[model samples]
Target chain A: MRALSGKVAIVGVAESDQIGRVPDKPAIMLHAEAARSALAEAGLTKDDVDGLFTAGISTTELGEYLGIQPKVTDNTSVGGSSFVIHVGHAATAIATGRCQVALVTHGESGRSRVGMPPRVTPPDSLRGQFEAPFGLPQPVGAYALACSRHMYEFGTTKEQLAEIAVATRKWAMLNPKAYLRDPITIEDVLNSRPICWPFNLLDCCLVTDAGGAFVMTSLERARDLRQHPIVVLGFGESHTHAMISQMPSYTSFAARQSGKVAFEMAGVTHDEIDLAMIYDSFTYTVLLSLEELGFCGKGEGGAFVSGQRTAPGGAFPMNTNGGGLSYTHPGMYGVFAVIEAVRQLRHDYLDQGIRQVPDASIALVHGTGGVLSSAGTAILARY
Target chain B: MSGYKKPLPKPDPVTAPFWESLKKHAMKIQRCNDTGKFFFYPRGLSPFTLSDNISWESVSGRGVVHAFTIVYQNRDPAFAEDVPYVVAIVELEEGVRLMSNLVGVEPDPGHVWIGMPVEIVYDDVTEEITLPRFRPVRAT
Candidate 1:
């Protein structure tokens, strides 16, 4: 457990100059812009970054685009959760001297599809053969299935689910950049038009153009950097199934395994989790993840999130960036979550004018990829 | 098929038997004889074991609605006309699960609930493929 704990730290984090719009830049251009900003923030130039990690594109392509010949590169695309796992990878790589500095970047043109290739699956693939035949719309279709089962098993009400959206909207209202900052009510959510039966348009996350990047280096090097280092205490990742049909249990997440490992390594419990930057591709994703991450008992997510507990001034502050529900959400929302966690820990979120959490020393940032099929958890603290 | 532009299952060598059985109006599941567990979406090896010794057997074609959703919109052009269609996962008595659609009932909050018993019905979409759907079982 001590092998990588506190050995590495995230020295800098940044987002593209333009987000929430179909940017003038291409996908690779976004990656470059974010990477350069992160480098500038860390007081390092391209030459200092020896490790490159990315998703939706190869690190080789990114290296060539950024003109950085990384000593180590990882292209671990596990959906939205890829970047958090990259931290664990970066920490281990730096500890082993594989690289001195690691830069992880994520950029997607979800709304504009600018320079992105069409996503196609062969007919015989797991998704094509079973899940696709029914013409299921993702990530809603797959997640709604799990929610329906959770409702059956636990009597989770649509009202309880709407509470999540309501709470998130309250947080969104505090952030000027949130795509939908207008305050929302549970009634409004219920009245919203349904995209998928169990999920209203409000329940689904916003589709926007965005990119985020961060740099990780050994703790020794981080002390000398201009930015305050957010120490990486623990990280864990797990996955059991890809397709919903193959998933062993609807209410469970592979995050249970990953969260346990992360918390144990960090030596922190739920009460000590100062801020939670959970991926909110949809409201259910947050609720289910809260339960899976051990914040609340299984089947108690509805009650746990009620009364806007995660909203401003609530007991727990989650998705302070307003989350994918209101904040700009590219195809992969994980990188943005990590960026927010870092900002909160640095007491730098005031740039958005939102009140900072009093004690942001310890944070739990959990990311889900592929419809809850994969989860990677990171425990970051400001040392 | 009402000019549906949604992707259809193109039965490959491994999954031909599953599609062929659907055409016969029968529900077939791959039973890993060694593990004594049933699996779906026809595969060569058991998910638990590497053993390819399997049997394709017909089940009762009756199961409980494990979960379901009514999709109001979709990405594909084939499903443009399929607004408010029901996508469901049914858990068969054989302990395996299959994803299909719900038929013969209204798709609404009051009508649909999890754990409702359902029986399989076939919708002959094309000459080669028959789409299996489920309807709520009438309390006998």
Candidate 2:
């Protein structure tokens, strides 16, 4: 596994206002806004973007509307982790000299918008439709099954899951851009109405109408830019299935296989990671990712998350931007994960009354798509 | 397989047999004709051979609990009445796992252990549908 160090860098990152409901705003507007913000952050305009990569948005329609003909464009929609996978792909493209600058963006009014055309339902050949009609229609319930299984197998109490929500809400309180900044507690998480067994309303992520984008450029190009470049050190990806039940192991994640590759490629160990931006579509996700990413041994995630390990100033500073659990989850959260990693590496929010991980150098960003179905991990470093 | 409602009419080609078998109080799994590999939650093709030579076979619906959980909360609104239910992933005799509710026993997590013997029992919730649930097999 070759390290991608110094081959490509995330030059800029930006996002749209995190709002609960933007009924009238088209999804494209959110994407365009984030795109413009990212270009500005990179000290470049839309004209400098030779490639466009988008997730959860209509690429052909958006590309036509943006009025910038891109030499390369990709619309890889792997659910929430689409943008993170795009970052890996864009890094490869930049390394191979296919495109100098690539923009990866995502936007969705998932809270307010309704009736978006279904992109790819699991094939009729899969058991998705059969199980879907049997009351497991979406990923939430599917993940709830895994949560229940986790609880049964490991004696993981509901309060333990609540700890993740409480920790994330505390971080959200300091993030002005976070959709839900109100302080929350384990009691709030426990008392909040249950959406599914083991998952309360607070345990679920915010359904925001937001967008986010990241601008990636070659290392040589980024070196000439004004701000410090966060280089893409390494990345790994794996996909099992779109349906949750198809996963081989309910307790273990396929992320270990990918995370191992990424870590090996980056030439860094888990101990060297200064910051981590794990995708938190649900509280259990973070717990599972922690175990899979080698933060703790297998089956020890239940006990590892106790004692505020993932909280601010803890052993690991994770999801510093509040994460999707408390901040904003506008359908595809992969873009926001990268955006926060870049910010943490750049030390951008230090003066915003937010607690910062001092001298943050290397950050790991992970994205899980489609009901624990696909995992993408990337290592970002500031040099 | 008599009590639960029939699943909403949808074209689930691969799992039609599994569902249709459940209606008859039986459990079926797909086995690859070429490689003799067994798979569950039915797929259109065999995972090992990638061949479409797959056929449904009935299982004894008897196995050990690979993993089990006593849910203090129920997921479906209809099952809300059945709180504190036990759902276990039973590894069937055919070497495939099925997620089904455990019945006919007190729901206690402490009393359960991995590799505990279990057997499937059909609950006739509705005339057309029989829900396959598991129960702890009593010690001989």
Candidate 3:
């Protein structure tokens, strides 16, 4: 099988004009605003975009709103990890000469709810028939259920999970755009109101308004773009059950399958990864991703994240942009994960201090979606 | 009664049998005829073999608490009044797992523990709907 490694490069990355709490702008406007800025950063125009990729929203509607007639389009909506998987799909399309310039964008009023469709689980659906009737309180309850099992099987502690929140909050303090900037400690997290058992209010991600986007093209054409091209080195995507009840094992996740393929295709060792952008819809998400991604041994995520190892200035730098826990998590957060990795690789915050991972050459960005159901991992490089 | 605000199971053709079984105070899950592996959330085909050779077999209404959580805040009107309830994943004696609520005990960490034995009890909420819930099993 031929590898898509080095075949595509991301040239531009940007967020909507305003990230947190823009109640006036609807989701589609956010998409247009981000696309405009991303295209300008790449020194390209809307006419130059031939491939449009988005999720959670209609592709045809976004295409008409953006005034772009793309030759190819993808509406692969697999929850939060949709955009990360789109990155891999775009690379494949470009490598096969299906399209030249691909635009991946995201916009959601997760908090404001303006122009957002009503969230529904129909009575006839599988979830409606089986899981929804139990009043699990979605996403959180599902995550909490898995966390309970993690604690049972591995003896993981709530204090250890608090360490992840503390570390990510530290990074959030450095980013001006992060939603929750105040510094918090383990005790503060532990003391926070309990939303669901095993998950305190502080452990949950903020629901805010935001939009993010990035532009990519063939590697040969990327060198001439406005910004340094960040190559799509290796990528992998996988999904397990949609319902938390049907999950094969609550303690393990599909990231193991996705991460292995990503690492193998990238041909890089664990130590070579300079930064990791694991989606943090919840603190346990990070700990589980760390273990499943081979950063640490299974049943050791609690110990691995102890003492703020993943915090800034620690042994490993992760979620430098605060992550969904502290930063803006507008429903789907995969695009923001890629946006942060691109910014770090380009040294966007080098002079600003603290948030940038010094000389960041390779980054592993992973996104978990749908109650820890789907995972998409991408290995990006700045060679 | 019109006052039961909680969400109820909406069964269709593929899943009507499971709900009908619950109305009779019994539990039946889809089992693959070939592999003898049982599956929950009844479906037409076997998840293991993807064959139409499936049967709705009666299963013991007994299981163990695989995992659980006590929800304190739920904004949905149907569930807001029922805060601090026990929502759990029960692994049945037949080896299939399903999400349900645990009753007959306080919704507290001290009262609930993983691997605790549980048995099913039917709640005939509406004329047409009967919800299946679990409770701690007493030692024989």
Candidate 4:
């Protein structure tokens, strides 16, 4: 396999025109808005783009909306991670000469629910037949089950899990665009209303309307662009189960495989990673991803994240964009994750003193989609 | 399937047999002849072997609760009336897992623990559909 290390560069990244709450705006408009912002940031126009990738809406629809006749397009909507996987796809597509100037976009009116199409998972489909009838609760309920099992198996504590939420909110305080910046404590998390057993309302990600976009091209082309190029070191994705029931193991899932592939492809180890922007759909997700990504040993996620280790002044800085817990969590957060990783690499945060990872050259971002059924990991480096 | 209050499975060709058997109050899962593996949520072929050499067979219908969660609230109206319910993953003797609600037991973390024995029981919620729920085996 051809190594993706430093082959392609992310020239520009941006979020939708407005996030948090745009009740009157449609989903497609957010897509177009983010796309225009990202393309302009790259000092390029839609006419210069030859490839487009996104989820929820068809690439053709997005292409038409953006008014670009793309020669290559992909709509791998596994969930939020779909866009993360697209980074690797676009990189390879550029490497293989499929297309240049690839644009990946995501926009969802999660809370506003305006101009969002109805999703119908066929009743006889894997989810509807096996999971729907069982009253297997949505994301929170399903993830709580995993957290409960992880605690039972590894002696993980709820307080240890609460540390993740507490630390992420601390990062949100530095981000002016963050949806929630109020300081919270472990007790606040525990006292929060219970959505599902083992998971308080604070333990879950926020529901908001948002969009994000990214532009990828060859390193040769990116150097001429206006912004510092964040290289795509390596990327990997995995899908094991659609429903949480078939997850094989609660504590371990696709993140294990995806992380391994990404690390090997990047030729980097966990010890060398300066920062990690992991998908924080739920607090348990951050904990388990840390463990599965080999940042820490199995069942040590609780101890690793304890004592504000990932907080502002902690040893390891993670989810500095506040994460889905406190950051804006549209339906799909993969693109937002990529956008944050790029911004951190470019020192784009307004308050770099608190938000930036000092001397942060290598960063890793991962996304979990479809109830932990699918996972994608990307290794980015600023040279 | 009419008059069903909750979401009902419109079984396709591959799953029609599974739902048909459920209507008769008999639970069946596909067993791969090659690998001798039993899997649930009936599929067209063995999930492991991916071969058509499969057979639907009956087992003890007894399983152990692998994990569980008590839902305080749900967005679906169908489950709004059933708040504070126990949704659990049960590992059957056949070595396959099934997601079902724990019946005949209260939804409490202190009360429910892993490895709790459970058995499948059919709940005829609609005329053409029968839901398979699990209860503590002792309560059966």
Candidate 5:
């Protein structure tokens, strides 16, 4: 179970110099800027990177922009969680000596639309044929469908969902770089305009332009790097169905499969996790993921997250960098989640006046992608 | 059908029969010949057995709304006019589910509920294309 555990460590992590609507920086430029920054932080040059991983953008494009020739490349674009899944892949490559140093990156101009190509789904595709014809505004509609079912089955209420947005915003206020820093309340979320039934506009993540990158190397080499190594103790990924309609169950997620593998490999229990960075594509994403990740019993997430349990000064500190809800969410937000986890574990923000989880030694980062179709869970530790 | 801006399904060979059956106002689902299990969103091979032992069979279009959402914002030019529409996933009595739109009822919280009985209704939006939607199964 611990084959790759502690064998690899994330040596450096950084976000693009500019995020949250940089109209001038194209998507590829964000990738380049983040890659450069992360490499520099690791005390390594682009030449030392033997593996390149990216999503939404191709490895070829990223490598050319960074002028690095990687011996191995992975463009596993499962959706937003693609970056988190890449960390698992990078760990495997490093463990097998397929590559010594792996660089995982993400860049998306989700809001500014700079250098972003037009998105087109062929009419003959599965989504085009089965799901797209009903005028369902994707993503939100898809997530709302699951939320509706959760409410029906588990009595999850708008109030319970609002608690998530409220808690996430609290964290956003503590970070200077967050896109929406103003505090929000449960009432504020419930009163926000409805985009899809059961999903108010406030419950959704921000649409912004951002890029993030991180470097991974063998644990032995990581100890010599510039930063404290956040060891990859366990990692697992799973995919069920791409189309939301085909999701095995509306109340549960594929994360159940992924999280089980990760926790078992890491040999850690829920009580030992010091912090969590769960994907917040929507409020329900967090609620359901908590349940599926075994943080709480099934159908109990609403009650579990009530009273801002995940907010600052609460029992469980999560998404301290604000998360996709208030932080920068380029088309995919997984890389940023990993970056925040590393910072907290390394105590990088201790003097920055930001709220880093005190003495956070173990962290659980879970990423969801493609309408909850894919999940990737990673357990990281500072020891 | 002029100015019909909504998105349309483009059927391939494997899914053409499902679309063709809708054109005839008779919905057909794929069933595994070996397992005798019906599946929606037709495919050539059985998902259970991964074999081509599959057959198309007609079934009662009666179902229930398993879940639904009233979409208020969709920026697609094809669907802009249909804002505040009801998009749902209906589970058929045969135990298969598919995505559709609810019609003949208001797209409001007061109207739609999970497990509400529904039946399929075909809409011939174009001369060659037909969409299968759903509506409440009225009490007899």
Candidate 6:
């Protein structure tokens, strides 16, 4: 797995409507707004983007709205990890001169929107008549089952899981864009009303009506751009299916394969990663990714995340911009992870005291989609 | 107000067997004839071999609990009354893990140990359907 190192760089990243219930806006609008914001951030206009990549939003629809005729377009929707996976394709497109600039964006009004299509249930074609009639309905309950298994197998206490929520809140306090900035404790997470067992309300991520986007360009084009170029060092992706039952292993994510591929491509180990922005749709997800990504040995993730090690100014500062848990989780959370990584590398948000890893050179961003069904891993660095 | 009713899941093509078999007080799994592999949530073909050589086979429903959790909260609104229910992943003698409710015991997280022996019991939910649940097997 050769890394796509130094071939492409994320020149700009931006988001739209971080908080509040926004039901009136359609999904495509969020995508367009985020795309415009990223272009503005990069000092480039919509006319400059030649390649358009998006997930969970219609590529042609977004392109039509942006008024750009893209030479290369990808709409690979592998759930939340789709955006991260597109980075690899974007890199390859840029490396071969298929396009000068590629923009990947995602947006959703999951909380406020209505008339959205129900999740796909295989083996039966009827609408809401197949799998939903059975026990597995929403993703929250399905993920809760996995969380319960983690607690049962490794003796992972609720407090240990709550540590993730508590730490993310500390970062969210600094981020004004965050939805839930109120300070919380482990007891608060434990005592919150249980949506599903082992997972109280606070254990889950915030449902946001937001959109995120990032602009990528070839190394040559990035050198001439306005800001310090954060190179796309490596990228990899893997997907299984939407159904929870189909997942090969409940505890270990498919991302382990992609993480290995990405790390191998970057020519770096877990120790070389100065910062990480692993998706935190649920607390168990982060814990599982830690084990799968080789950050710690299997069954040691519970012990690894202890003592606020992932908190601000801790051993490994992760999800520094509050992540999907405390920040915004408008449908797909993959693009937001990339946004945080690029921001941290560029030292753009330092005035807010969010930059903990000073001179941070290497960073990893990972994304999960479906019910832990698909995963994408990427490594970014300041060269 | 409507009278209290246990909201049992409606049987569909995939789960019709598990529900229908409960009417006969039996536990079964869809086993592939060619490869002799077993699967849950019944399907038309074997997942591994993708062969249409699959049929329903009855088992003793005797197995060990691979993993168990005492859920203090219920996700379904109908099961609100049954708070703190025990759910376990039972590994059948045929070597497949299935998710089902554990009954005939107290909901103690510590008491439900992994790899503990367990057996099936069919609880009649409807005239046409019976739900297959599990309970701890008494040590001889």
- TM-score: model 5, chain A: 0.98
Model 5 chain A weakest lDDT span, ten residues long: A349-358
Q: Candidate 6 lDDT, tens digit per residue, A115-199? A: 2456444433321322333343256656766776777677888888888988888888888888889999989999998665667
- The native-contact fractions of the candidates, in order shown, are 0.86, 0.13, 0.78, 0.75, 0.87, 0.13
lDDT of 2 by residue, A6-87 (tens): 5899998888644557777778887888888888889998888888898766678778767778878888787787788888
TM-score of candidate 2 relative to the true fold: 0.87
Return the lDDT, model 5, position B116: 97
In candidate 1, what are the lDDT values of residues B74-129, reduced to their tens digit?
86777878788888889999988888899888877568888889999998877767
lDDT of 2 at A50: 82
Residue A128 accuracy (lDDT) in model 4: 84
- Where does model 3 exceed 4 Å of error? none
Candidate 1: residue A346 lDDT (0-100): 88
* Candidate 3 to native Cα RMSD, angstroms: 0.9
DockQ for each of the predicted structures, in order? 0.78, 0.25, 0.84, 0.76, 0.89, 0.25
lDDT of 5 by residue, A1-383 (tens): 68888899999998999999899999888888899999999998899999999999789988888888898999999998899999899999999999999999888899999999898778889999998788787788999999999999999999999999999999999888999999888989989998999999998999999999999999999988899999999989999999999998998888998899999999999999999999999999999999999999999999999999999888999888999999888778999999999999999878855387888999999999999899999999995
Worst 10-residue lDDT window, candidate 6 chain B: B1-10
Q: Report the C-alpha displacement of residue A102, candidate 4, in angstroms.
A: 0.7
A215-307, model 1: which lDDT tens digit per residue?
A: 999999999999889999999999988888778899998889989999998888789889899999888899999999999999999999988
Q: Which consecutive 10 residues in model 4 chain A have the weakest lDDT in total?
A: A347-356
lDDT of 6 by residue, B28-105 (tens): 778988888887667777877888888998889899876555566655675666767766667789977666678888
User: Using Cα atoms with residue i matched to residue i, what is each candidate's TM-score against the true structure?
Assistant: 0.97, 0.87, 0.99, 0.97, 0.99, 0.88
**True lDDT of residue B35, candidate 3:** 99
The positional error of residue A135 in candidate 1, measured at the CA in angstroms, is 1.4
> What is the lDDT ranking, best to worst?
3, 5, 4, 1, 6, 2
Q: After superposition, how far is residue A79 of candidate 5 from its true place, in Å?
A: 0.7
Docking class of 4: medium
